[model samples]
Target: MIEERGRVLSVEPGAVWVETVRSSTCGNCAAKAGCGQELLQRLGSGGSRGFVRALTDRQWQVGDEVVIGVPEDALVRGALWVYMMPLLALFVVALSAQALGGSEPQVILAALAGLAFGFVLVRWHALRASRDPRLTPQVMGAAGFSGVPLTNL
Candidate 1:
């Protein structure tokens, strides 16, 4: 289980939203710095990220510590493919059309269109999946502690 501790912001019969605290270590990572994620992290005014998850055995209060898990299959199958396939498909379609079509500007435009299409497809799929009940994530377990409950100070 991919578990992180967060506080319950809301709860329903099937789900609870726990807000996870993202740490400075997020920006301190070498990969994040190189990827420009550090600058993106700095733009956030909040310390936590809210995750709406399906509830299992866990009892929750507004401030209770709850564990959230995004299944490995879901991570690999849903999130990974949703983004990766689009990009890969973009490049493949673009490069193949360029190589086979024999037109430079057309190839370039095809590639740009592919890239844009890939990004948009990922976002579209993500939104669609989140709205579907079959795709909802499961709850892991619960904890007693909240995040430093994710404070600005």
Candidate 2:
């Protein structure tokens, strides 16, 4: 299980809302001083708060600290769905368009169209997958100790 500690923002029946800040990995990288990522992190750090809703039976109150966990495999699968699928779709469509003997300009337009279609499909899939319990984070318990920072995904 991948776990992170956060403070409870709110509580509702069978669910709790927790806010987590994304810690920048750039801080540990040698190239951070010269990296665009470091600049962006400085500029947008406050915008990194992500509100996560996790299902739990234990009673929780506002401002209470808690630990949330999600399966590591679920995180990996989610990454593949978000990144790989779109690239695969783009290549498949572009190759198919080329196989159909399209001209250069036509092929370029076809590739752009394919990319847009891939993004649309990703959005559709995300909406459906949000309801999957296996993919959702769970409230493990009250946060009694500090844990590693959570990813913003």
Candidate 3:
């Protein structure tokens, strides 16, 4: 589980909404230059974000440091989709080409097609994975370290 400190923006019967604090790692990511996510994070000229996650047990109030997570399993599953799919595609294409005596151009096209399809599938899966309730971070306790002072409601 990955943890980040966020401030609670709201609370309901079964969940809490938190405004996430932007991290330096986010700014350092190689894809930050082109991703819409980095652009959104840059909003407020570089400050916090409105990140809402549902919590099952725990009461939160405004100005609290609630920890959130990018669950381990979700991370692993997503990696396989993004990293393994293209390689599998390339392998399948190469084997099929050898069997059919296809031209080099045709074989390369198959690899490229696989790359495109893999990228699309990975992106889709990531979006869905993010919404899983079990994957979210929960409030452990309280701290007086920084940002908003922690509180319970």
Best by TM-score: 2
Error of 2 at 64 (Å): 0.8
Question: Candidate 3: lDDT over CA atoms?
Answer: 0.68
Q: Tell me the tens digit of each residue's lDDT in model 2 across 1-153.
A: 998778788889999999876567887899999988898888986347778999899999888878899999988887888898778878888888899999888888888888888888889989998999888999999777444533322
Q: Write the per-residue lDDT of candidate 1 for residues 1-153, one digit (tens) a residue.
A: 566666678887767877776555664466875665566667874354555666655566776666666666666777676668677867887888877975988887787788888888787788888887545665666664453533331
Residue-level error in angstroms, candidate 3, position 1: 2.8
Clashing pairs in 1: none
Best by lDDT: 2
Going through the candidates in the order shown, the clash numbers are 0, 0, 1
lDDT of 3 at 99: 72
TM-score for each candidate, following the candidate numbering: 0.66, 0.85, 0.60
Check candidate 3 and list the clashing pairs.
Answer: 69-137
